[model samples]
Target: MTGKINSENGYVKVEIHKVFKVLLSILLCFPVIGMIVLILIDTKEFSPILIVVMLLQVLMIRYIFIGLAFKFLSKDSLNRLRDVLDIEWIKNQA
Candidate 1:
């Protein structure tokens, strides 16, 4: 325990790192879904720049997975996500 409380029932307490990992893990799925949606739908009207940006975002998701697989990193390190609000790790994000 970090001696910090983030809601507890005396049976379970969530640590700052635990919450950070879970949120990042869940959000990493978004890019996959976006790629699928793009594949399934027609986007001929979309500008070339927009399509390129979307593909770059999709590519960044792979790096995010790699970062987590190697070491604990903040969302800023992950690049596509934001730091958790008011969480303890926000200060160490850099």
Candidate 2:
């Protein structure tokens, strides 16, 4: 837990890193979002509720992908995230 928190820049650096990862993950889903828009446009029907629902679904999908990537991609960050969430991890001592 302490390892993830650095006193160097008052957490601004860590926060920025988190934000960058979130933005990058969302940006990665832009292609899918574009396809959704194209499909709606091609159908020649415009529904505000449908558009909102689709966008929300895309956001949740992006969030799930980002969570999985963080968990599998970087163990360190995963642990850090767990720490941030106040999840307790048992330590085994030999």
Candidate 3:
């Protein structure tokens, strides 16, 4: 889907692409799913310390992806993207 910005009644509306949304969702799920499968497949192979480390890693990855998703979907991010893209140029050309 195409991205668009609309301003009505002093509010700005931005439509983000579906592909990006889907990608973020996948990223958010991957680490948790991977860790779950790992634990299920070999609970005895990992020591307690190693399991703790792995859990920490999963949490860190999940946190990072969540932050990225929120940042990308935030209003400030949309405004920044618009500024970087120079929407006025496209408008002028049209």
Candidate 4:
């Protein structure tokens, strides 16, 4: 099947398995729990601060990984947008 995006089509087709989706949701809970812990605590200490920062770092890394994965997975849509814009630019130039 062609993964190319068309005007009639919305996005590139990328198959994400159900198992991975479930695992990803489970993994996301760690950060949420960490945030809840941080919110419940009242402290001016090093260890809790460190833990929160580490949790934030992990969440940020996860976010970046997901974003990059989606970008590469839906590249056909990006290419289609670029092509459409290029055509418009050429038409305007002429």
Error of 4 at 16 (Å): 4.3
Query: What C-alpha lDDT values do all the predictions have?
Result: 0.51, 0.59, 0.61, 0.60
Residue-level lDDT of model 4, residues 1-94, one tens digit each, is 1355444433334555678778877776777676667667845443556666777767775778766786686666556755864532112122
| lDDT of each residue in 1-94, candidate 2, tens digit only | 1344333321211222667778886786786677677776776665557767677767766677666665565667656765776665544353
lDDT per residue (tens digit) for residues 43-89 in model 1: 66545565577667756765665456544643344332223323333
* Predicted structure 2, TM vs. truth: 0.37
The best candidate by TM-score is 3
Candidate 3 segments whose C-alpha is farther than 4 A from its true place: 1-9, 46-94
Better model by TM-score: candidate 3 vs candidate 4: 3
**Residue 24 deviation, candidate 3, in Å?**
0.9
Better of 2 and 4 by lDDT: 4
Expressed as tens digits, the lDDT of each residue in 4-84 for candidate 3 is: 445521234455468876876676676567777877999888565765766776677666755666666675765676697
**What is the Cα-based lDDT of residue 78 in candidate 3?**
56
Q: Which residue window of length 10 is worst by lDDT in model 2?
A: 7-16
Instruction: List the candidates' TM-scores in order.
Output: 0.32, 0.37, 0.42, 0.39
Any idea what lDDT model 4 has? 0.60
Check candidate 3 and list the clashing pairs: none
Query: Lowest summed-lDDT stretch of 10 residues in model 3?
Result: 1-10
